[model samples]
Structures are given as structure tokens and as C-alpha cells.
Target: MFHYTKLDIFCNDVKKFADADGYVPEAEDICQDFSYPDTQFKGLKNWTQHIQSSVHATRSAQQKLHAWQNRL
Candidate 1:
């Protein structure tokens, strides 16, 4: 059985992979369209939230995929 600690490590790696796989940059591109482009405060905050949620959602999907694969 995979431990929860291992799952965390997997999620972290998934996040890194998501970054390298263009998930983060895509989020940045999307958030770039927001009104506060010049300011780091609101834009940064918005993109940060958006990117984090995106990565988290992708990671969860990957986790479910792996679980399903293992079950099969």
C-alpha cells in the first residue's frame, strides 16, 4: 500500500511536472488578460490562486488516474 507521505511526494512531483508540462505557463497566459497587468499585487495574487488551483486539480486527476490504473 502507498503511504500518505508518498502520495504527498507524488503530488509535489506532479506539480513540478505540471509546471514543466506548461500547465503553469498556460495559467500565467490566462491570468495575463486580467486588468491589473502592471501591478504585482492583485495580478500576482490572482495568478497565484489560479495557477495553484489548476495544478491541484490536475494533480488530483492524475492521482485518480493512477488509482484506477492500479485497480485494473
Candidate 2:
């Protein structure tokens, strides 16, 4: 049986892999489109939120995948 400590390590490694595999420069492109001050701030804020959510999803997926790996 895999120990909880090993699972924790696996999760951390998986997060690194997911970040490398799933990262997209376009995901952070909104930071550069500062044409209008008000609108850009709002758009950037939304985009930043999206990036955060995506990263969280990727981390969750990594955790599940790692758990399956351990099961197998």
C-alpha cells in the first residue's frame, strides 16, 4: 500500500507536470491588452480569475491521476 507521504509527493510531482503540460501563454494575454484603463482592469481581473480557476482544475486533475496511478 502506498503511504500518505508518498501520495503527497506524487501529487506535488503531478502538479509540476500538469503546469508544464497545460500552461499556455495566451492564458495570461489579457495583462498586455491595456488599451482602456477601466475596461482593461475589469478584463484583466476576469482573465486572472479564469487562470486561477484553470490552475486549480489542473491541480485537481493531477491529484486524481496520481491517485489512480497509486491504485494501479
RMSD of each: 10.2, 11.1
Q: Evaluate model 2: give its TM-score.
A: 0.43
User: TM-scores of the models, in the given order?
Assistant: 0.42, 0.43
lDDT of 2 by residue, 1-72 (tens): 111233344345333322223332224444443322345336656657645754564556557767777795
lDDT of 1 by residue, 1-72 (tens): 121233443445444423322333334355444333355436567667756765666568567768866985
Model 2: residues with Cα > 4 Å off, grouped in runs? 1-42
Can you list the residue pairs that collide in candidate 1?
Answer: none
For all candidates in order, the CA lDDT equals 0.48, 0.43
The CA lDDT at 19 in model 2 is 24
Worst 10 residues of 1 by lDDT: 1-10
Pull out the clashing pairs in model 2: none
Q: For this target, which candidate reaches the highest TM-score against the unseen true structure? A: 2
Model 1 has a clash total of 0
